[model samples]
Target: MKRIAVLGSGTAGLHLSYALVNSGAFQVTVYTDRTPEEVKRGRVSSTQVHFGPARAREAAYGMPLWEAGPELESIHVTVGGQKLFTGGLVHPAKSVDQRAYFFRCMKDLEAKGVSFVYGRVDEERLQELARAYDLIVDCSGKRGPIAPFPQIGELSPVTTPQRKCSAGYFHGVVPLEPAGVSITILPGAGELFEIPALTALGPVTILFIESVPGGPLDVFGGIKDPESFRDRMRAVVDRHFPAVAARVDGEHFGLCDERGFVQIAVQPAVHRPYCTVGGTLVLGCGDSVVLNDPITGQGCNTASYCAEQLVRTLTEEPVGPWDERTGEAYWKRIRDYVTEVTQWSNAMMGPLPDHAVGRLMAAAADPAAADRIAGWFADPATAYEDLFRSAAGTKEQAERQGGL
Candidate 1:
């Protein structure tokens, strides 16, 4: 059997494993840092609400959209209380429980005959794996140990620690619009996202906020207790976003694992040797290679996109000298798209670009502009706009601010 080892059984690792097993040409084994149950129970931020294209990818991956309990509706957008134009931000944008959906992928892949190797991968363990498999894929995510992938090469969108994010999923909160997501951007202050989700446990609401670093959330500072976290969150909502303040309750959240405030940046080298063994190469995929700041909720979508490309490349060709080429191609295909998404994400961290603000004002005032920007989220290319087009008109924002 042609053997491939994938480190990190997260979304990218699991999805690629599923694709390869379904092909029946490769024997795929996934190595993860936690048990299947632990992996299943792991806490992740209320992070993903897919655009139509992303949902399509999920369906293609054989993740049951119906059983996954997706909430497909629309997205509502506003900046500084000025309603920007909204369109099909995600034409039928859909969401699912990150934890549940992840496990479901694992279960289906196992049923189809893929193997799971659970535990952390030290260098020696990886070497043993390298000796056995024809190829190795690192999907170890942000905290990956196998790859020393700290942000390097290009200047990242966030140089210093950027924002602190707090989030939780609630059981009830009547949405403001018809089955869509909501975004409220307070210039240079914070960003809020509310999405209705269909969890296996039941329907839940995900309310998340990102604030300017060191702004005022002292309670979230190096804290791990649930009581403290929820209290801090409630205080924040009450102080800044009082409209939905009272609805903030800890009753629904027994524990929140995805709550953390970390700096955000974008980086992926186009031609790095993922790993080498006697001239053989193992590559990094998913967030290990490219982690878009979750600022705009593109992490899952990007993971899916990379997983698809990696699957196609691994199955279609032989892994030898061309492995480097494959890695470059992997980086090439995602670089532009990620750049667009990252730029857009970085923009959310600060004051909305005046032009973007103007565009929003124009969109709210002009229906056409509203639809155009909203469409950009689902299919950026279709909008004839680059999601990463710098917020600085003409001048790249990175250069204009000389900040990045």
Candidate 2:
């Protein structure tokens, strides 16, 4: 059997393993730092998923929504307390407990006959594993083993100091509306994303805020424990976002990590087809290739999208020299689309254009424009020709909108 080693059993690794196993010709062994049981139980990132990407990635693995749900029905964009706009599955948002979803994905893959190994993958370890497998795939999201390659200016573009994000899980009262999820953009200070998700505590909501470099959270003021964080979150919402704060009742628990904001970013996105030592071929995906800022919640989608392209590349592309020359075909397939998403995400971290924000508000006021924007979020490539390379507003839609 052609052994394929997948480093990091997180979302990307597991998803790629499942997809590879389904082909029935390759053997997949998942390597990770934590034991399967420990990982399945520990605190993981809190995630709010939209139906379009979630469903697309799942189908890529031949899995069903039963692991997560029937699929969230819709998503609404709002600010403060007032509803700005409402839209349905032109793209939908489904809230999911990250741990539950990750483990479920792991379980489903195991049942399909894929293998997993637990250990940290370092430079030495990766090279050792490379000798044993016919191919190696790095699905290490975020903290995964990295392959040193030439740092392309835009290909791996990133600003120093990653963005900080603090998120919490709360229970008690349900949200006022029932679209499955609500995303409120605060623009300057931060943005709060509230979504109804499935969790051990039954159904609940997640309130998360993303603070840029110099934002208020820099002092680590509001958001320590459930109570203090609640007070702090309340203060912000009360002053800037009364509508969302009003829905705050009962108890709210910090997801994990008392740290004010989580910091992460990477060279926009880069993939080296046959990353190797000597001449062996190694592939990478997810945060390893590009750890996108979590602001837009596109992390999982980025990983899965890479896996999708990898599977097809391995199947059709002549498994070339497992060297730089051979790996080009794999990353090239989806680079344009992935690049657009990554660049757009990076741009979002910067200051929001006043006129653009005004236009967003206007769009929110007009459901049609909001719906179009929602669809853009769900899948920018579908609506825009070059989302990664060009600036955010330079799309065909923007030209039609008359530069807002």
Q: After superposition, how far is residue 5 of candidate 1 from its true place, in Å?
A: 0.8
Q: In model 2, which residue pairs have backbone atoms overlapping below 3 Å?
A: 32-119, 81-243, 156-267, 165-261, 165-262, 273-327, 340-388
Q: Relative to the unseen true structure, what is the C-alpha lDDT of residue 217 in candidate 2, on a scale of 0 to 100?
A: 42
True-structure lDDT of candidate 1? 0.64
lDDT of each: 0.64, 0.64
How many pairs of residues collide in model 2?
7
Query: Pairing residues by index, what is the TM-score of model 1?
Result: 0.84
* Cα TM-score per model: 0.84, 0.84
Per-residue lDDT of 360-390 in model 1, one digit per residue for the tens?
A: 6766777666667767667644332532333
What residue pairs are clashing in model 1? 85-370, 340-388
- On the 0 to 100 scale, the lDDT of residue 310 in model 2 is 82
